[model samples]
Target: MSEPMLDDDALLRYSRQILLKQIDIEGQLRLSRSRVLIVGLGGLGSPVALYLAAAGVGELHLADFDTVDLSNLQRQVMHDSASIGVSKVDSAITRLAALNPQVQLVAHHQALDSDSLAAAVAAVDLVLDCSDNFSTREAVNAACVAARKPLVSGAAIRLEGQLSVFDPRNPDSPCYHCLYGHGSEAELTCSEAGVVGPLVGLVGSLQALEALKLLAGFGEPLVGRLLLIDALGSRFRELRVKRDPACGVCGHAQ
Candidate 1:
């Protein structure tokens, strides 16, 4: 098939991204035609949203129910002090739109539940889970598994961060549940545990990069592996992840 024609503005805007041999004009076209759903507008969600929008993803669906607070300014780069009290989704979309008007923005001004979650996951080619809470992470993972959409998941707290891709498209790959074991009932949140600011930026940017690679059909993703970052010591580690045979989610299929 002939590649979609890029307008002059698109060429100039995405010149750097397009220059990579892995993401040439053809790959840029794929990016321009793709859609991704991001859950959350907090720490991790902030960088994921910004980089993805700047990379020229065709459409981005931003989901978050919380309103911006003064405390959020530390890491939620998508919002400013003036945005306090405004819906996070609105704040994020406004910032992202300002970054790149070439992409379409879908703002979901509501929290994600099973029903809404499935619908949102189903609508996008890929999903990025940047929410800090484990319950929401599990719900997003389940929805992605049910929809068979690829997911780039990231988390950060107290200078620790991890990122991985759960692609049902890869039969042998594990879903988030297989690696994390459905999360404990005693899951922790950044609000309670206290997270470092840049930790979210580091992990979330990687999530955005993985999503773009997945959508553009280029680069080796973090599929079947979890990357751990300990910024306090400036260390990095990776663990190979595989589907659990007797486990739920992708296990049976694998």
Candidate 2:
């Protein structure tokens, strides 16, 4: 498919990005031609959907089987009190549409089984695993590896957060399972362990930035590194990750 031409309003709306040589008209056009899939529509997906929609991504595929709850309003900034009972994808659609009417929004408001998840990953240029569970992250990672697509995965719990990018296209990059095998004993959700709202916001915002860098074909992605956040001390740390040749999920992949 041909890349869509940027209209006059689009040029003006994204003028600041176009002003930067790293993401000039060509990069903006690439973003406009890209399609992305976000696995969850909670805290991480909230910022991801907002920024990508505002930045004029041509298509966004939002998938979530949950609905907004009153408790989610604290960090799920994309949804409001009025949308407490609405489907997260539907609520996000309303917010994203208002943010950027130019970007097309596709909703998958159902629990995606193995076959559906594989199909979803194969249909997108990239995948963002914003789901707040270990099983979902592992599932998303496996799908991305099978499809040879990039996956930006993030997690936040208590006062800490984690972010990483796993791209099967890069042999040096580690898949999610390579770094976190089977699952960690430390996998805790916000509901069980508790979390500060802003910590999630910060992590989600970074996830959005990483997606933009990947889509625009500029800046180095965190493909072989893990970013750890300590919100209690406001400290950030990076850990180098190597691909595991013996990885069961991605060893035979790519």
Candidate 3:
């Protein structure tokens, strides 16, 4: 007989997910053995962290230096007014653990930089880039490429949200760099562009779905394609994306 699962509480908590044909007890077991790293705890990161924890991911590493602010409550579902001034990672851990105690929360209450990104990505099976800055996003992509880990990236501004997966393990898959090019300071931020609160919820939830698909290997992920949702116009579009032959990060590997 197969080795029995070690945690009954985990099994009970994940019963709904385990009931799915695509995620039976075996998949639940796998989820309890995987580690995910999220590089933000804001709009996109909030849902990503919440859903992944609820899904019973064994380990979750949250990296964010910023503290909760009144503005964050608009899109960040994991925090409240009482959490304002507390580090995002810390607040996220408290909320996520309350959601699913089986998940081990690792809080990195520091900003992500070259050194930290290298170390953080090296320890996780997957990385989710939800930071709203180009420099951080590019740094995350580079770190994932270096570690050959699957990355689930998402963004929302105004009424638009976009999501894509960059699995370096796939020879034909496109890295984030392949689609957005390198970092540019001109990229818009919520401070300047203004994002709808629900818009973030929509996009952040999709990021969770993509992350779950990668973890369970149950569905086709958005590895070589991008999903664009324009809530203002109520339009959804899928665009084909390819690995750039000259992409400094993924090109040589491909």
Candidate 4:
């Protein structure tokens, strides 16, 4: 089928990106036709949602069961003082609509059960795992694997951050579980470990970039590569991530 056509206003709004060699008019149109699901609305999700909306991703499904807390204002740029005490999805909608009304925003404020999560992953072209906990990340990974969708995952804690892309579409691309392996609940959360606000912001911004690359069909997504950021020391490093043939979550060849 032909892609959705861009109107005059859309052409003007995305003129800068359309001028790029990598993301010419074609790429911008692909972005305008893409659909994505983000699994969090906290520090990591804030930038991911903001940039993707501004860049003109066709539709975004935001899933966050938690309400906005005052503490989230420090990093969750999508939510402001007025948003405090409201659902995070509601807050993001108010903010994103103002940024780009043309972009569709779907809310999933309820905590997703196994069935709901699977359905959510199945509906999207790609999934971003911005959730803070291990269990949610694991569930998202499993859902993506089962549906054969690409998963962009990011994590930040204290002064450290990590990012990677695991595409079930690419047989060589490792799933999230392949790298971390049965993570223990002993993982320290940002609240408990005390995360620096900007660390997550930086990671989330990169995650947004990766998503844009995949959606707009420009540049290389971080497939099978792990990025490590040491914020305190200001260092960036990339490590190759190999798929584990014995991985429990995604063990079979497509």
Per-candidate TM-scores read: 0.97, 0.98, 0.96, 0.98
RMSD of 1: 1.3
Model 1 alpha-carbon drift over 4 Å, by segment: 1-3
Model 3: residues with Cα > 4 Å off, grouped in runs: 1-6
lDDT of 2: 0.92
lDDT of candidate 1 at residue 181, scale 0 to 100 = 83
Task: Note the Cα lDDT for every prediction shown.
Answer: 0.89, 0.92, 0.89, 0.92
Error of 3 at 67 (Å): 0.5
Error of 3 at 208 (Å): 0.8
- Compose the digit string of candidate 1's lDDT tens values, residues 14-108: 99988999999999999899999999989989999999999999999999999999988998888999899999998887898889989899988
RMSD of candidate 2 to true structure, Å: 1.2
Error of 2 at 192 (Å): 0.3
Tens-digit per-residue lDDT, 94-153, candidate 4: 999999999999999998889999999999999999999999999999999999988999
lDDT of 1 at 167: 93
Q: What digit string (tens of lDDT, one per residue) describes model 3 on residues 45-89?
A: 999999999998889999999999998898899999999999888
